[model samples]
Target: MTLSAQLGIIVGYLVLALLIGLSAYRLTDRTAADFYLASRTLGTVVLLSTTFATLLSAFTFFAGPNIAYHEGPEWILVMGLMDGIIFAILWYVIGYKQWLLGQQYDYVTLGEMLGDRFGSGLLRGLIAAVSLLWLFPYVMLQQVGAGTALETLTDGAIPYWAGAGLITAFMILYVVLAGMRGIAWTDTLQGAFMLVVTWVAMLWLLTAIGGPTSATAALETEAAAHVALGSDHYTPQWMLSRALVIGFGVAMFPQVNQRFFAAGSRTVLKRSFALWPILCVLLFVPSFMIGAWAHGLDVTVPADGNVLPIVLTEFTPGWFAALVIAGAMAAMMSSSDSMLLSGSSYFTRDLYRPLAEFSSRDVSERREDLLARVGVVVFATAAFLVSLVNPATLFELGDAAFSGFAQLALPVLAALYWRRTTRAGIGAGILLSQTFYLLSHFTTVVPGTYAGWTAGVVGMALGLGATVGVSLVTTPAAAERRALYFDGNETGAE
Candidate 1:
């Protein structure tokens, strides 16, 4: 397709998104709950669609398929299919508990619930800090993806910086003007478009590459001896370890946590989680297949990561290819909006609120919502600047940033089920785990960091141990505070 036609497609998509954002403005409530949580009024269909679409981002559309092309079908087994199942299970097992508590406590951010549970502002502050820190890099990822997509669509006439800037501007405008209401509705439309594009691309790729049997045979026949599973590489240990690192670390990310908390009810959350696996299968199965098919077509893999886009252009028609490119933009922007909103919430509620000593009870909720909107602009600006430099550092920062947050997941989970978990203990655990995880992440000599997943594991272990030990040594939180943390409802007689 010519550059003019591609620009037309891109403009049309943006206009459609703008209309949705404008329409949702009336649906938005003036209060903090309305802006941030949608007044807990999200129905099953809206919640499910938004969550699924939000989760499917630039990484899923691009890198996921690229992994399959380079690594063969085993990559699907190792990362693609299993990753979806893990998310589904997480929703049921871990997410349900969070939903149950969020409703009872009327929590907006995960940090808010943590602060209340642990009876410590500092702990909540730390969670907020970690969330904001990690989320910057995530926003950077979307910025990079948007730049890449536009460059491809415009045939490099629009540079990466210009494209990223445009995306960042759109995100800040929509999020600030409409808040979560704007983001949720935009995600609904963007996600549906991506879904259509994915299936169309997949079907065409399969036909162009021959049937399933041919694709499978070609991959197996061309497999490198060194790269094959059970060789020096891709062994049982290597395979399982890689899967666990990508699965667990990505799952523990706070952006996903925001989605879980956004869910209005336990039933809606459960149904969404259960249905996510099917989407994962449908979206990725074809991408992985296309990756393998590339081997037979003798197409030089672009940048190791560019394989998916390369194959799309090579095999699909121009108009269809342009649509898929626009879909990539949709996927990237959906995740960006979610991450920016989450980061802003953490900054406003967890960081600035405590440090400024504002009483949540006394403040006008409208003012609080305004602060969150301002924070979104601040975060997006910083992310755009960071995109100007080395983009890969963004993902590395993700690893370094969230080690602390991941450690607290254990204490947060513990506080729900274990009544005896004292504030002092949980607080100590959070400190110890974060300190150790950061130190370990920097030190290659440390065996744990090489393993990648060990940062969270080791951090959680140290944090938990120290927390429990400290609580036993010191006095517990007041009986009333303890009741609220453990059971969600206080029974005064107890």
Candidate 2:
């Protein structure tokens, strides 16, 4: 009966998602711009919700709580409070400028803008490559979360592989069918569902576990460390580093950056960002508290740190538990679909379009759309295979993904604001930073002694240094090009 209830809830949720996709498909036009970017028609609400939903991924749903369960509530401080402010600032700083440029130039991808700015196919390819490297792992994290959630919810009745496949299949169908329009619409719905279910589940759990006061009291008595913040793991430097990396890195994610192109206007973008911090507080506080509460509960946390399902099954009724599981699944699928779409867009717009003999203007829009859909399938399948391996904890995988993308922050900023930024300099910065980060991952060069400082931070600093130093020695971009981006009142230079 329990298994049937759980299956029914999941199937029902997926059907709703499919219907939303079909609706989006019905409205979608055949143009590449319309297919890839929703014709830049997203309003304030859908823009905010889709970006919020895409940003808060399986990592937040599963790994965040898992970290809090073991490490204490400091995870909330690292991501919930600090990350909220950090990303909000970035949204204002990077997003507005990107939207302005995208509006004037009709750019659908970040790589396209950067490549045109620098006139370097190498730079374009580099950005796309780095994005894919980080994006692949992040997408795999969603699959892992989905598989683990279902496996735990059904008590092994549904295997991990089956769970992962189910999400992959649904995501592929919806994304390929409707593209960005479908993704945004579905994301808005999923985002709202996630917020409501998570809050309700948290309130219900708190009440059942003798309220917040009782939970904290139990934690203090049984595991005082879980309530406090003196662990060797979280240092001031470490926390600050995490805040910076995630703040800058998340802003540059291909999927998130593409949303800049999807916004109807600057007003819509601003309105969405204004509401982001509040949403963060609502969603993350409860999630981390749930994990902290689980530390004090009688339940045994799983080895994989998938405590959400265990808590839901043990504390909540089967029906409520199933719905909450669906919410979690919603978070995973929303993020996965966005990432898959962005990855395909990067390949199609940045990589293939440049190298292909056929002019994009000359080619049929249907052919281009078909190619993008194929890329989506290929990328999703690869990510699914990686999820089967289950390489690391969700937190660790998320950290790696953030680190790789964060390295691009310096280069991206330079391209936007620093007219003196040369192609060689930007290329040097990206290559050096990524190389350093990769080496640090494999080697003991960057000791784990510091709390928030990782190889990624070190690499970012090096990349920034390299960019500045190289730009000094190299020729600056043309005055016309500089004027195009930086000159007041002008949209862009033709």
Candidate 3:
């Protein structure tokens, strides 16, 4: 196929997405609840689809296969089996609780929920700041992946900036257009599109290479190190760290955490969690297998290039390859739009609204919604600018974002279950743990990982310990404040 024809396929996909976004806008009201939480109307299908698509980003589309291609297929253990189960359990433990509270209190963002419970505006702003800060890299990562993927597939016809900008522009439009309602619908479309394309690419590659049996034989004969697991990269320490970082960390991401509030009912949330592991295997198993098979072929891959794109172009037709590339873009776009939408909520509600009130200026819901939309555009532009830097590999940037968000998990857990958890305790936990995690990553003041401990593990341990110990020493929150979250008379009350 000609370059124009291949590009046309991608263009058509974008137009379809735009149409979806527009259609979703028709169903929406201008309220913050409608914009951010879809009016709490998500059913199991849309809830599961949106959550899955939002979490499956450039990291999964590119870095996942890239790892399996270079390392062994043991990545399946971390990303597929362990993360699938762990995140599902977290959904029930954290998400279900949040949903129950949200149903009664109409809580939208994690910061709002925590801040209200602790009766601390500073804590709300701080949590929101941390969320927005870590979200920037992950958002930039999607743009970087989109740009790099386009550059690779066109064999450099498309410059990196153009590709990155294209997606960023579209993502900003989607969030600003329809908000969560539109994004969720579009996410469902994108999720199914990418999942099928991945399976097709894997099957085609296996057919061209004779079969999985043949691929395995080739892997054993050549690149035998990767054919087997438990070597350099798949050490117990690294593997466990990946699972811990990805599983716990991902659940607390502003985007993913927002979904916890969006669930229409406990049944919808329950079904989504129940089916998540199957979705995990369906996506990760094929993606990682493609990478492992690519290792056996030892296909010539460019510097910092994704092997899946190279292998697809080699074995598949140009149009099919173009379609598959669009699939990768689907994953990136879905995740980016969610990030922008969620970040906007944090900014306007947790950050901007509080500052406005501090000045004795009340923010109306209409004004708040407008500010949130503005936040989306501004943040998208910022991410696009950062994407051009090429700071690190997809995995490195992703792992950093994951580890950063993981620090929130422990403090949040303490808040939900322990009524004795004080504002002082939670505040200390957030500050000290986040400070340590940042130092470990940015300054090398501390090692990012030691032995089997990723920065996230170290951070979470410190956070939990601080929360428990401080809560013991400090005064508990007022009795009335605790009743809203935990009534001793209520069954199953914390």
lDDT of 2 at 151: 92
lDDT tens digits by residue: candidate 1, 1-494: 78778777776787678679789988887876777777776667777667766666666666656655655556666555346765566566567777777778888787788788766787788878866766677678778777776776565798889888988887787777776777788877877777777777878877887866776666667775412555443456555554444454454566667666677666777667667767777767766666656776667765624566677778887777777877777777777777777777778888877876755445456667778888889889988998878447323443444444556666665665666677777777767776677667667645563343455566666777887788778777653266664444755323
TM-score of 3: 0.97
lDDT of 3 by residue, 60-156 (tens): 9898888888887888889975568989999999999899999889898999999889888888999999999899899988998999888888989
How good is model 1 by TM-score? 0.88
lDDT of 2 by residue, 215-261 (tens): 99988887887777757777777877777778788988898989888
Evaluation by lDDT, superior candidate among 1 and 2: 2
Question: Which 10-residue window of candidate 3 scores lowest in summed lDDT?
Answer: 476-485
Local distance difference test, each candidate = 0.69, 0.84, 0.88
How far residue 214's Cα lies from its native spot in candidate 2, in Å, is 0.7
Per-model TM-score on C-alpha atoms: 0.88, 0.95, 0.97
Query: Better model by TM-score, 2 or 3?
Result: 3
Per-residue error for 188 in candidate 1, Å, reads: 2.3
**Maximum-lDDT candidate:** 3
Better of 1 and 3 by lDDT: 3
